[model samples]
Each structure stands twice: as structure tokens, then as C-alpha cells.
Target: MNIKQADFVKSAVFERDYPEELEHFEFAFVGRSNVGKSSLINSITNRNKLAKTSKTPGRTQLINYFLVNKEFYFVDLPGYGFAKVPKEMKREWGQTMERYLASPRHKLVFVLLDIRRVPSGEDLDMLEWLDHYGTPFKIIFTKMDKLSNNEKFKALKAIKTKVDFHNDDVFFHSSLNNNGKDEILNYVEACLNGEVE
Candidate 1:
């Protein structure tokens, strides 16, 4: 989808005070530190710089919000697991992440996983937590361009064997190549409307 205008809305410590404007549907992107969450957001929105991409892990320490056409909000939540941040900062980040996921505001969260390698400890933990909490979420494996077609198939198959994903639910995407952009957009849009696509 062509984002007419995408702007940083606000970063909230608590979900209640996130943004009073619920007129728009909400969707969030989350994963481990530097798992290409920002890149994925930019790719899907077709905005090369909508969300800041950083080589430095854990650059996004806050719950960054972006509004797309005022129809929905795309949230760039803080990455968990592997931040080289300070001990005190990491503790606070964990707390922030828990609160963010547990809150009902924008209940639909998209957890991005790196397809180049198997899901990490924190990645699996997040998925399990979401499942335990009964939160609505979907897993999108990113960085498909790094793998050959045969390798991609094998990697996807491996992931499925481990995770038990339904057919339409799992996706393969390459942010650089702009693959699966349309499907991701449609999925998020459907979730924003509170309906299964």
C-alpha cells in the first residue's frame, strides 16, 4: 500500500496513554534486537525511511508509533533478548515489553522472526508468552533474500516442523526485494479491522 503520509506519532510507557485516537486500527511489529523489524516496516509501507533502521542493535528503546494514512497505526515496539544496553536499561526494557504485550491496546501484534536461522530462545519465549496470554499475534519470518530458493523451502519446512503453523498464516518475506509486501499489508489491515482475512 502507498503510504500517503507516515509520521512518528508518540512513544508511550503505558498502553492506556498511547494515543486516544482509536479511530484507526492498530498493528505492531516486534522481535529480538535488530531482527530487521524496522526494515520490514519500511519495506511493507514502501517508505524507505518510515521507521529508522539501525546497524546498532536495540536502537529503538521505546514504543515508537507511526500512523499510515490515518487508517491504521504501525507500532515499532522495542526489541527484546539481545540489546547491548546497560543492565538497568535492560531490566526496564523487559518491564516495558511485558506491559506493552499484556495490554489490550492494539492487541494484534506481529512477531518478526529471522528466517536465516532457527528461532532463538527469546523468540520462542515471546511466542510462548503470547500463546499463554491468549494474545492475538502472527509470526512472519524475515530476510528471505539471504537464502536460496531451496534453502528457503528447507528453512520454512524446519520452522513449520517446530512451530505448527497453518498454511496461510506463515509468510516468507525479503524487505530489500519487496516480496510479500501486499500480503503483509492485507493481513495487517484485516487485523486492524478485527477480522480474519
Candidate 2:
């Protein structure tokens, strides 16, 4: 899983206007605000500060694209959930993300969750919607270093019970230690490269 060359592609305010050509199998990361979406990406790609992590929430306003090894595009989408920003602004942001997730044109999605905390209501909502819409997605547990063995198992079990998705699609991950980074990246590359599943 060596990402020889990674580059930031573009940023978009709306999904409809986001690069019309789905030339590559794009991998999009979605989760609540400050759910380590940016940090997870940076850690997984082994690129420090590539995704722009911050202590503050709601900073990622648009959909950002990063090309990986010239094979697949890692799409860093705006995080949804509670934000420190204004209510009106958050509502607009939600709509923007929704359009992208529900898009029939797009292919794969990855739902990121913090390992220590239980799956929140919003997280469940997103998973349910993805299943209802039949979107191909997988779950990635982030920040595993903060959790104990028992806690990690509990989190995984709860997520499995709640998400109405294929069991094989569920994946465990930790971006901080780069555990499961290769598994995730390899899976995405396999899917995008049209290799047999």
C-alpha cells in the first residue's frame, strides 16, 4: 500500500458540480464533525498534514479530492453532525453532503466512527440511509489507540447490530497507528482496479 504519489485534486461546494466524469472509483470518507476524518486519512496515507486536521470542527466546507498512486481518488467530504457553527450554516452543509451520498453516479463510500464512543444517532441514521438507498459502503473504526480490548469489541458489535449492511463489508481500522490502513487501501484499490472480488 505504498502511495508513491498523492496530490490534491479539487474542492467543490456541490456534488452535482463535482467533476462530472467518474473516471476512477472514488473513495469518500464521511462522518460527524471532528470524527478524525481528516486525521484518519493523513495517518492511513502516511502523509503528515495532508488532510488538514484541526481542533475546531466544521472547517472542511467543500468536497476535497486527493489522488492516490494515480490509481484511485480519495475524496475527503465535509463532516456532518453537531458543529460549532451556526444552525443555518450546518443545515446547508448537510444538504450538500446528502446530495453526494445519495448520488447514483458515485460508487463507494466509507463511514468513519470514533472507536471509544458508541455509535451516535446520526451515525446510525447515515448507515440506515445508505442501506435503504443500496449504496455500497463499509464502516471504519478510527482512533483505536484510545480504546481497550473490551471497548473495541463492544463498539464493533454495536455497529454490526445497527447497520443493515453486508457482514463482509464491515472493516475495523485505526488511523493513528496505521493499523488496518493497508487492508482498507488494498480493498479500495481492488474494487477500483476492477479486480475480482
Residue-level lDDT of model 1, residues 1-197, one tens digit each, is 45677777888777675876566557888899888999998887778888899999998888888878877788888888778889899878778788878876645788898887778878888899999998888888888888898998888788776677875777667898989878887776666566773
lDDT of 2: 0.79
**Residue 183 in candidate 1 has what lDDT?**
85
Model 1 earns a TM-score of 0.91
Q: Tens-digit lDDT track for model 2 on 1-197? A: 57777788788777556765557777889998888899878876778878999889888878888878876778888887777888888888888788888776656889988766677898988888888999877898788788889987776777667655454666667766778788887887788778833
Candidate lDDT (C-alpha), each: 0.81, 0.79
Question: Whose lDDT is greatest here?
Answer: 1
Could you tell me the C-alpha RMSD of candidate 2 in Å?
A: 2.2
| TM-score of every candidate relative to the true structure | 0.91, 0.88
In Å, residue 9's CA in model 1 sits off its true spot by 0.6
